[model samples]
Target: MYNSIKEIVTAANETGKTIAELTIEQECQLSGKSRDEIWQRMTVNLQTMQAAVQRGESGRGVFSQTHLTGGEAVKIKNYRASHHPLSGDVMMAAVQGAIATNEVNAAMGVVCATPTAGSSGTLPGILFMLKERLSLTKKQMIDFLFTAGGVGLVIANHAGIAGATGGCQAEVGSASAMGAAAAVEAANGTPEQSAQAMSIAISNLLGLVCDPIAGLVEIPCVKRNAIGAGNALIAADMALAGCTSKIPTDECIMAMDKVGRGLPASLRETGIGGLAGTPTGQAIKARIFGNEV
Candidate 1:
């Protein structure tokens, strides 16, 4: 199996296989499962994501116990219905889907964590929206996830994936990169273009910290996922348009790991710095926990 982003790209180039095909082959080898079985599971993941989006847009059971994240998806939908959106359908849908998935996670509902729950929203948000925007078939949508998973596998093995270990740069940044790679492939770009998309995406989010208010993945995490989805879309479009990253994809992932390691602990999901340390953030924590700020 390909271990690094470079290797993944090399294998795809050598075999003349799509990123999705390489990833699916690796998954089959790793899991000892048939291709049909793996495909079926990914289909279930897509269905779950679609359901969370629907629930989020419906504005039902969207609130958490702390009420930190909820109803934002519905608000976006309502705004779109009334006013002409400047961002257009795909972006608007991506934002809505991202927020919806995170809101579901916050509400303790079911969600398919593309890599991790805190960063889960990016993939589904863009994937489902692109399904309509690009007129992709179900098979193509599943292929998108596999392509993204290839990137994630490389990052997780080479650098890291958890915010606790590598800060939000590892979590949301990796997820955004993965989504961007997948989007490039889904749009019929080559494996090399997908890797470039991932590089561009992660490079832009290099130092993002993982500061959750009250240690809850609600405050900035939810909104950050929305932005991550947007970043993925932009990066994918850039790559498809023949834009390239000066830094290679593997080097970008390594840089993200280094940045995360250099970050202070307060910024790594500690809830003691960044936006979580703001006066309003402290007050919200106090209000939620019944403690003085």
Candidate 2:
């Protein structure tokens, strides 16, 4: 029912409710399902996300068929366990969680795509990090997902969440923006702050192309999720620190949409441009498909 970020915030303020609560209410109306039903469904998604993160951090991650992305999450986890990461534990943990989720995705493992499978890592990265840092209960974690959903809905409506239609900016960018706003709400920031977090997150990665090397969601896609998690954290922190986005979230999303559209067709998940166009990229494609590409 919420068409824009501002509208959702206004509704939340007027009703003295959370963006998560409003999102649940709207889903009830749109899907004609009871609140309990919707909550149960979301609970499953939350559980799935948690499971994927845990699997990735298990020190023996699953590898994709192409062996392109696999155990990097475990490597991150181990590295942080033994060494002082320059980015600190929180950021590294987010990176670990984000990479783990996407690695699992590349392996064809189950994951709850916040908006899309190609960009599944961002929300869980921040959400789980907050879960441990803030000691979030299961219900609270689910609320975080709903808050993310509210922001993602606005972006999907105005711009899109498909890499094919809007490039990696729409997939990873929107997911990161969703995570930023949701992280803000989970940290008890105001709805307006959540909107600001979303704006900053979207603008930070606008026009990111969706060039999966060798047409696989490995190479850059998996690493991009790690960066998306970092972006979400930075944006959320900025909003919580009383920072405001000069461009409203709705405008930021629109701007992202225009930029994604302006990108050449080669950049929009076609797997034939960007890194995919490089000589090494061509060699990988040839190795994978044997002249088929």
Candidate 2 local lDDT, 1-293, one digit each (tens)? 78898899999899999999999999999999999999999999998998999998885887899997899898888889899999999899999999999999999999998899989998899988999999999999999999999779889999999888899999999999999999999999999999999999999999999998888999799999988999999999999999998998999999999998999989999998999899999899899989966
**Residue pairs that clash (backbone atoms under 3 angstroms), model 2:** none
Which has the greatest lDDT?
Answer: 2
Off by over 4 Å in 2: none
Candidate 1, residues 1-293, lDDT tens digits: the string is 78788888889889999989988999899999999999999889989988988888894538988888898988888887888789886798898889988999988889998799998888889998998888999989988989988889889987788888898888888889999999988888888899999999999899999999988989899999988999999999999999999999888988888888899999988899999999999988888887843
What does the lDDT read for residue 275 in candidate 1? 93
Question: How many clashing residue pairs appear in each of the predictions shown?
Answer: 0, 0
Model 1 TM-score is 0.96
Q: Which ten residues in a row have the lowest lDDT in candidate 2?
A: 54-63
Find the number of clashing residue pairs for candidate 1. Answer: 0
